[model samples]
Target: MNELLTKLSECIEFGKINMASPYPPNMKGQEGADEITRKALEEGVNPQDILSLGLMPGMERIGVKFRENKVFVPQVLMSAKAMSTAMLHLKPHFLSGAAKQKGTFIIGTVLGDLHDIGKNLVGMMVEGNGYKVIDLGTDVNSEKFIDAAKENPDAVIGLSALLTTTMVNMEKIARDIKEAVPGTLVTIGGAPVNNDFCARIGADHYSPDPQGVVEFLNTKFA
Candidate 1:
């Protein structure tokens, strides 16, 4: 059983989607995350254990690799794809209350920014780490963010911006969220964002990488 779980983890870490997927070359023709995860469930392995011991470990390794620049966006996106495929099997368990998520996370690319690659990566990473991610997509505004936050009062908010011009909008959104929903945690990121900007904008946190966002949520909720 443990071996099966380990295989599942390897599938995610190496971006193996299924036996049919061949992108990773060496992992080709092997049962991948999609297959292994379903097999684990068939054998009666607890869903939560599959998530914690299998999926999370794989995602953590990939996250660290991404942060260290050992892997690039293409690799990370492949891993996210594998993870998301496996998650389809687990979603029912979550809905049935057999598994619980860490918390809700609302993420978006701030207004004036049409970039989505960075925002999508963060959403995938957060979701892989057990948070229920609600992606607002690109070109998001202050009102949309505040509305989502109000709907999910306990949720954390993440803002992404790839351009210096659009990054400034994070301040407005962050401030508005805080004003409309005091004590809400707002995290800002993207190429033009940093801890200094985060402070200046009155946002709660800033992280250059997706793993940092995961760690922040874990620490905040733990």
Candidate 2:
């Protein structure tokens, strides 16, 4: 059983979606995340184990690789794809509370920023790490962020802005959420933002990559 779980983890790490997927050519035709996950569940492997042991480890490894520049966007995206594909078998368990999530994460691109690739990647990484991610999509503003924060008071908020001009809105959004929910945590990231900007905005954390966000969440919620 442990061996099966390990194989499932490998599938996610290598971007194998299924038996038919040809990605990561080295693993061509091997049973991928989609199949391994199902096999684990059918054999009565705990869904939570599938998440914690199988999925999270794979995600953490790929995330660290991404931060180190050992892997690029295409590789990370394929890994994310594999993770989501496996999640299909586990989603029902999560929804039914048979499996647990670490916490809630509210993510979006700040106002006037139409870019979603960064936001989506962060969402996928955070979600794969066991947090329930609520993506508010692009063009997000303070009002929308505040509302979501109120609705999920315990959730950590994440803001993304690819354009320098739009990065200013992160400050306002962070400030607004903190005011609306005095103890809420805010994390900011993007091409034009950094720890210096995060400090200036009073956001709780800033990460250059998805792995950094996952590590921050683990520390805060551990």
Please give, for residues 138-174, the per-residue lDDT of candidate 2 as tens digits.
9998999989988997899999999999877788888
lDDT of 1 at 117: 89
lDDT of 1 by residue, 118-218 (tens): 88999999998888999999999999999999999899999999989886687888889999999899998999888899999999999999999999999
Give the clashing residue pairs of candidate 2, or none: none
Q: What TM-score against the true fold does each predicted structure earn?
A: 0.97, 0.97
**What TM-score number comes out for model 1?**
0.97
Q: Worst ten-residue run, lDDT, model 1?
A: 165-174
Runs of candidate 1 with Cα error greater than 4 angstroms are: none
lDDT of each: 0.91, 0.91
How far in Å is the alpha carbon of 141 misplaced in model 2?
0.9
Over 4 Å off, model 2: none
